[model samples]
Target chain A: MLTIHNLQKIYNGTTVVNLTELTITAGESVGLVGNNGAGKTTLFRMILDLIRPSKGEVLSKGTNVMQSGDWKNYTGSYLDEGFLIDYLTTEEYFKFIGDLHGLSGGDVVERLAPFTDLFNGEILNQRKYIRDYSKGNQKKIGIAAAALSNPELLILDEPFANLDPSSQIRLKNLLKKFREEKQMTMLISSHDLSHVIDVCERIVILEKGQVVQDMQTTENTLQELETYFTV
Target chain B: MLLTLLSHQWKAKLRSSIFQKSLVLNIILGLLILYFGSIFLLLGFGLHKILGNMYPGQDVVGIFNSALLFCFLIDLFFRFLMQELPVLAVQPYLHLPIAKNKLVHYVLVKSVPSIFNLFPLLVFVPFMYTSVMPAYGAAVAIVWVATLLLVTLLNNYLLMYFKRQMSTKPLYTLAFGVAIVGLMLLDYFGVLQLKAISETLFGAVLVNPWLAVVPLVLLAGTYLLNFYYLKAHTYPEELELRKTNTATGGDIAFLNRFGELGKLIELELKLIWRHKRTRSIAMMSVMFLFYGFLFYGKGKFMDGFGTLIFVGIILSGMPMFNYGQFLPGWQSGHFDGLLTQKNISPYQFYTAKYWMMVPVTVLAFILTLPYGFFGYKIILINAATLLYNVGVNVFVIFFFSVYNKERLDLSKGATFNWQGVGASKFVMMLPAMALPILIYLPFGLTGIPYAGIAALGGLGFLGIIFRKQLLQWSANRFVAHKYKLAAGYRQS
Candidate 1:
């Protein structure tokens, strides 16, 4: 459903992302794995049209993402804290996101019902702003907000980084359920290998902005990814 | 250790993004300092002669001494408003090997060199040289000048202590402000003879320089108070001026009727209400509603359409100008989120801002409608400018909105925070303020000033009628520049 053609992002003569071509099919769950400075977030930013590619363009559903905003209609993305409006309460923020998607207040609560386990009772009815929440709680809020609309395609960067272990497992199961039930296309980037492998059907290992390996997940995929990631 | 800490502060100032990003702003700031510095120096050298002319055949020294009390009082009030507490700079060092006492002293002494404390020296020292040194002997002149400096520092430490107490015991700060205003009012109504008291007190000081000890002792007491306070609460959270607020404001239920546009406006209003900087801008806008009193009744400004038009524009447009200059930057934190959101078109985005600013401009105009009581002419001029503000100037702000790219930290106070201010802000003000007056100038010169006022209002009426096209034009501009803006904000 998304395609990148010769995508490149250059900062001060050094290329941060340089992809000749990459494409994701509909209802495909793909995991992006990279180390620090691998330009994983930069690639996601380009696909989301938050950053203009230095070369070529990103096409969503056969239309250039930059030339038209139609991709945003079916795309929900959370890359960092920048995606979350910190001043709003979690409920207010969810209601806002819900409103954007024409969801009523009750509709918002219904949509957020799936995240109750992931929320761990720390997120809702806290009567605190998102800024006052802990880092892990904030991540949960961001992830849930990204999923609030049940968009056709969802993009998240480092979704498991700040989450607690149990919440991370819950998020993995949540992603699996969304893919199984709604046929949602997800593009998730993570540092945790096993969690991503468990969540995504396919894994793309990125090294310094280039895809060094792309393979379908199997029982041995985790061992292969661990071997490739090892020094 | 103190020197090292001071050096770090100096480096921090030099390397801050706001300071290093814009050389034009730096030059403007430098020229402003020079401009004000020279003006104060000239005023200092000329004060004795001016006072002599006002109170002829009187002891100019005694006159100056009497006014010093009032000057210090006004200075304290201004310091309370403008001065920032220097608590955060010590946070990094708190866990270091440095002693808490040394850090506390650094925080207090660091405030000693601020513009509030040092700028007055430009006037005071020059006055001492021209007036006091010659009138009194060198020893007495030195004592008088030293006493003034002591009081200035006394105000500095006193402000630090009281301002720190502001969060915990706000009543102290309020009581302090009330007492100062009360003293001024009592002096104004002639219930208290502050001038006579001040004259006698400083006269006694000039006769015996030992009387300076009073201010010195008071300064010491406030300093020790600050020192002990800082020593006990060196933790960053306690030293913070504002605690993390419990989320206070709720959704404005009425806003739900407008759909997404309403959501955007509601979000922006909550943004303004929740943040320290934006809230201060709102408060400052309200304060500026009284700004017409400075020029409305004055004969010099009343007769001229030009000056009145300028005043009217400022009266109605201050809030818009103050807040609008930082347009999308206020959302810079979530700008990427905004860009990637569903169905949030550029046109709708600017439309939300347009509708948001229009009512505020109109509300400001209505609030300042009392200025019309000065004259029907004042009403005519204000009504014209109000139209111009809501119609033309709002578009002018939108026209320049795309250039704002810096991220704003909403948590800080707006007083001296220059985080997102750029040269474009100053540039944007030029057309918004000057264009209406320029529109009026030709007709005024042609001896048809009322037509000029009408013409200004006429242009605004036309702008309002064609606002859809103007908004479209603004959105097109935003679309053209969105990529560059997104890139810039991401850097910070």
Candidate 2:
């Protein structure tokens, strides 16, 4: 349940993001596909209020994300390493996040039990600081921490990037499970077409900061998107 | 190949985002350097006159010769403090076809441009012209100047090696410190005369111009040692060994009681201890707590209440000034996490910082309580200044910190890294120093100085009383700038 209205982020006369209108309804899983400068990450940053939007506002569940702190309660985002505190160990970071969400230590332990396989035994019980973790492992830690709070709305940018093949598959399965069982709202942006098609119920393609195409997932949706992206 | 690498480095320096963003800051820094250069030039020109004034009827050249070694030793100490190893920037080139020798040579040559090497020449060259050239003739004077430059270079490379060794094993630093102090003490007592030894060695160089070869040899030796050391340890794992790793986990159970904010404070404490730059700065602040001994030991500043206030502020207020100046930049690494993932209100964050400074100020006061043994009045003055520092300077520093939008890389050493510095940092000094002086000056000028000191304490106490309101105000300020700060933090 997120809405972008007249949103524009301009940098020195260049429009970085200029979405006229975009909305993801409750319980919908959407995949954002774009070229490098398509403003996918910029849009996510505006939604999180990490950067100020130039013209309009982003609304989450009828609340202006900029004007209030209520949306952060149920919004989970992992756009980059900025989302993770690198100085802390994985467990410490999780515990701190859990405490922020008012989850007991026991609750955090139970919640993390499901990610043990996704973690591939290298993350949990590992005594290394997050800074020392490999980039792919760090990605896993960030993605896992984004969902650690059990937020109703999840946004992950390039979640499949930097991930090993097995972890990527595991992550796809996890997102599928969350989508079906919990009916969670997710907005995932990735360059990986197959994975996006595999998980998302709807697909939105962006070009030059504008939404060029929006469609519900159909049997030929993958073929249609691939053909569109073919130069 | 080396030329290409050097050109790349040149381009990197000119094209860096920091260089472009900090043009005004760099101009100010350049002006400051020019100012220091003028001072050293004045000192160089006036060397003979000053030495004659100090040691009347003595040979100024002999005096200068004796002092040369001492000056170079002090220069070495300062180089250890100020010089950064330039080799770290070569990481991107490691996979290229560049030879490791060329890279090491490039790093060593790059260090030559540092201000440290230029400084001694400014102070020494004019003296050599005015004093030695006339007396020794131009040829011998040239030899003497060449010798001095070579010795300076020798000290630079020697200390570079020592610093690199010390980084790998701190025991080398301890041993070096012990050796230096031992020599100083040996010279302080009549056991050994460093002045006499320096006089003999350098004075001999003046007499025999050929003796310049000795310093030349020493310089070459040190340069080769550093060259080979770099060659031997060019690999990433070997370089990683050079960094000292301490225990990562430290539990502060007391912090657990404060809930999420407490956890943040605990995390801040861990950040300070775990990082080299922060840990060293924090330790240096603590070391400065004993700095009162420098003035108080000599029985100076006894009645100068203004001086006492300065000491008190230096003792108690410096940690806040030094550490608080960075503020959220210190959290730049995880600032986005702080903003989006957590439900932390700006008010709670500011309050946590306020509480964190309280203990530091209190600890400072406790440490200075012994100064009260010097005089009950000294204790009273310190207590008042302590309160002023905690109450007023804390908030003032925090207020100024909001303007410091530049992000800091926490892992970088603090000595010369100017990542978070801007015009705001310079402006911050105005309130920190002038406000306290403004508050105290009127009382001293009036007949009753003690009352003025007490008035300062009263103001500080009022600040403490209304801290909640002040924190609320600070929190509101933080919230207003939150987006701008978050964007700045994300840049790096």
Best by lDDT: 1
Those runs of model 1 whose alpha carbons end farther than 4 Å from true positions after fitting are: A1-231
lDDT of 2 by residue, A117-199 (tens): 88999998888668668889999998888887888899999999999999999999999988898888999999999999999
- TM for chain B in all models? 0.98, 0.94
* Model 1 Cα lDDT, one tens digit per residue, B1-492: 688667657756876768888898899899989999999999889998999999999988899889888988999989888888897776534322245678889998888888888888888888889888898888988888888899999999988888889999999989988999999999999999889988988888899899999889999999999998887776555788998688989999998999999999999999999999999999999999999999989999987889899999999999999999999888888899999999799999999999899899899988988888899998888899988888899899999999998888888899988888889989999999988888988899999999999998998999999999999999999999999899888765
What's the fnat for candidate 2, on a 0 to 1 scale? 0.00
Model 2 error, position B189 (Å): 2.1
Clashing pairs in 1: none
Model 2 TM-score, 2 decimals = 0.68
| lDDT digits (tens) for residues A20-101 of candidate 1 | 8889999999999989998998898778765657898999999997666677778888887766656567887787677667
Poorest stretch of ten by lDDT in candidate 1 chain B: B91-100
Pairs in clash, predicted candidate 2: none
Residue B217 shift from truth in candidate 2, angstroms: 1.3
